[model samples]
Target: MSGSGTFAFTVHPRGRLREDLARAWRPLGLVPEAVYDAALRRLPLPPVTMATAQIGGERVGDVVLVPFGARHLLADVVGGRRRVGQAVDRAVALGADVVGLGALTATVTAGGMTLGERTDIGVTNGNAFTAAIVEDQIRLLLDRTAGGGSRPHIAIVGASGSVGSAVTRLLARDPAGARLTLIARTAPRLDALAADVADSVEVAVAHTIDAVADADLVVLLTASADTLLGPQHLAPGAVVLDATQPRNTSPDLRVQRPDVLIVDGGIVSVPSLRLRGGDIGLPDGRSYACFAETAILALTGHRGHFSLGNPTLERIDEIRARARELSHLGFRAAEPTSFGAPIALESRSAVIA
Candidate 1:
């Protein structure tokens, strides 16, 4: 494939209320929430074009709406799979070299693995670059918390996930040596991931978020829509990297805890790419690493399915290497953002203590 390769990333409404606000549904405000929910599913909103961008001939991408919410898909996984497959096929029809899955679409499709197996066109969950960014943020946090020559304890809430597992491997291979607490719902998957890194670094597995209570650094990557982290689960001066869709960090944590810092996961600085139309849910010059992954793959001339299923270290490193070779493209983790703005570290109470 050439550098002019085209990519498309998929998205869905997070919830009915969010969609109502996005479409300015004041006229429909009187309608009951359950009515709106059923109407959305039965109506099957068509694929809407959310955003489109092209940076000369280096890269081209279109973000299209999948019109499905996490709850909708999770409720009917079989139908959700069909919807995802159909959506990718339509994207391929629109000249997409690779189709990227976003939101709950990835979780429902098993990290785009199912679609990759069914479609000839390339498919990606964009986990490779997302994993790289997570590791980069974790490294920065570790450096900030460096003290006493005491090895940092890293707890990953979704250690069995694509992004989590990739970073788990990357961190374990680091010579500085950090103890890892792998927390996830499934014991088998957690054990498997732990075994991969247990020899390289001390590893522990936990099935609850409480396991993070004493961790120096915690990474959240679960698909859970609920806030699982609370005040009791946080350690003083700990760093929380929240990379989940619905956000696993409790809102109360912000109101009550002043010593725990957060580095928003998945957001990356993309200073060069210019958008002429549509909003990508980011301020100018910033985007989610998953969306950036497909764009980078296009720029790097990768023409096959990438970042499907669980990610590997080799894939993460490869994507990062390819990204660096592009001129004027600076891809790195962005600072923690609150309410659409990046917050200064010194200004945050989490860093004061």
Candidate 2:
């Protein structure tokens, strides 16, 4: 898997919030040139670099650094389909057997469909693999914290989004008998999603934070523009999967809730990749699920969109099988980390309680 093969490319934009807001406001008449100038004066320039990895004897590459810094830029680039096409072309030129879109890239690309149409190489959004990892993490947390006694009540925030809906459906089918809560800004959409899973579990809709007040486990996959869950909102001994890229978890939680466990959803480990950097937020040797999906597909020689749409139970199983078959060459979620601190399973109970 090492000598000149398929490369996985992860595209990342670098900048702080003020810079992003200034860029957005520049196009509008909202802010004056002086304001933009002042903001830039105070902003520290951050360089965006492409994070590449070689997996399964093949080189997996990621294309980081877009011109714009906000989610809107991400959405626009992949929204029209033409830009996603261009992005895919760039990946293929870099020797990618399959390209995986991360976060907003995947969301706006329409589940890799548009990108696939534009690129000769395979394209995948990697949601199926993400679902698998999220579920695995939830189970691990429950086992460590709850002693596997009773299924923890779980809440899927942003349940109307593509990833959130899929996660809700998957959790509903689990035999753990965990109570499930579906949260979204759109009440109707939440209700519909809940109805879809009605047969599997008792599902309810939550349009506000109060709905998730009693939740023991929370999976946040929302595309919301602002942070939804904060330290005050969560109960003690809670486990949260911050699936959103910029993150939906509040910064205050780091100092506020030492008892709750927070794990980034996309982190996974892939074989044959030697990462020199000590750790980039994730535990050492682990890659994001989106990153791993591209490598996994390259390893198994799958060159198509493996996961898309509001993922269903059936689709989840299919991806799990594919991941399992390539288990020798797959990625696992990074261990739980709190406020940028690593949490060991043995010590998790004491820290949370």
Candidate 3:
């Protein structure tokens, strides 16, 4: 497999809706907040190429803006999907080998399948590797904090989703016994996911976050833009692995509950990477797993939609295999980080106290 091709992914506004707008353009700083939001509803800037890097030869990293905030996208999924489809069109025009849905754009498209009709080129939500990273970190957390003999109670908030379901199935297969609780907004979907993993381990399904309070560990994979988890929703000394883009954990939750451990999930670091036009809330070398997925596909000469819909064990394993093949080039998972800071063993172990 030759590593020669162009890769691009869609990006949306990060941080506060109005502030994100002002940061992107200096002129918007003077515009009133009300008028700025009103303009965003009616008029969206066309797919703009914010930053691109030619990482030796044909290996190009292009970051394109879909130009909408998270709340807006969550509110108007149909419109967001259309906007992301347009962004993919821009990527196709640039001769991208693969286009990826970044941030909440994947939520809007339901892991990229909703946009299938809009493009002949492959589209991926990059949930496969995202799931993989979270799974790895959880294993590490459990091994370190619970010792090898204990089966810490684990709850997945978005257990029916691509990332959440993949982790649930993966953990279920592990030899160490751990009681699993699948929490999601949809009861039927939660039941379905529980059924899928029940043979390997015992599973309890719930339709709300209430089921998580008793669990030792919690994983958030909900697609909603809202901050669904807080101190009240979690038991003291609980560990949370959050994989959502805008993040399901509230800043206030972190402030009020120092006893709880909430680690940012699926954040990876890419080697020698230079990206502009967006801030992924990391230093320079790191990125979200979904974006890293597209980059790996491009460099590996992998064509077709690599990761889409709910992630599977096969997809998770495949991405790891690909990453291993190119491990020396350095597109792999980084250390556990909460918010933007690195999480230490002491920091995480305190949650078990």
Best by lDDT: 3
| Prediction 1 global C-alpha lDDT | 0.76
Clashes per candidate (backbone, < 3 Å): 0, 25, 0
lDDT of 2 by residue, 102-144 (tens): 6666666666655544446777787877877877887777777
Q: lDDT for model 3, on a 0 to 1 scale?
A: 0.78
lDDT of each: 0.76, 0.63, 0.78
TM-score of 1: 0.89
Query: Compared with the true structure, what per-residue lDDT tens digits does model 1 show for residues 231-254?
Result: 888888777889877567765676
- Write out the backbone clash pairs for model 3: none
Ranking by TM-score: 3, 1, 2
- Model 3 C-alpha lDDT per residue in residues 272-307, reported as the tens digit of each score: 666555444566677888888888777777888877
Cα deviation at 280, candidate 1, in Å, is 3.2
The candidate with the higher lDDT, 2 or 3, is: 3
Kindly report which residue stretches of model 3 are placed more than 4 angstroms away from their true locations once superposed. Answer: 22-32, 53-59, 147-149, 347-353
By the lDDT metric, which is better: model 1 or model 2?
Answer: 1
Q: By summed lDDT, which 10 consecutive residues of candidate 1 come out lowest?
A: 344-353
Instruction: Report RMSD (Å) for each prediction in the order shown.
Output: 3.1, 6.1, 2.7
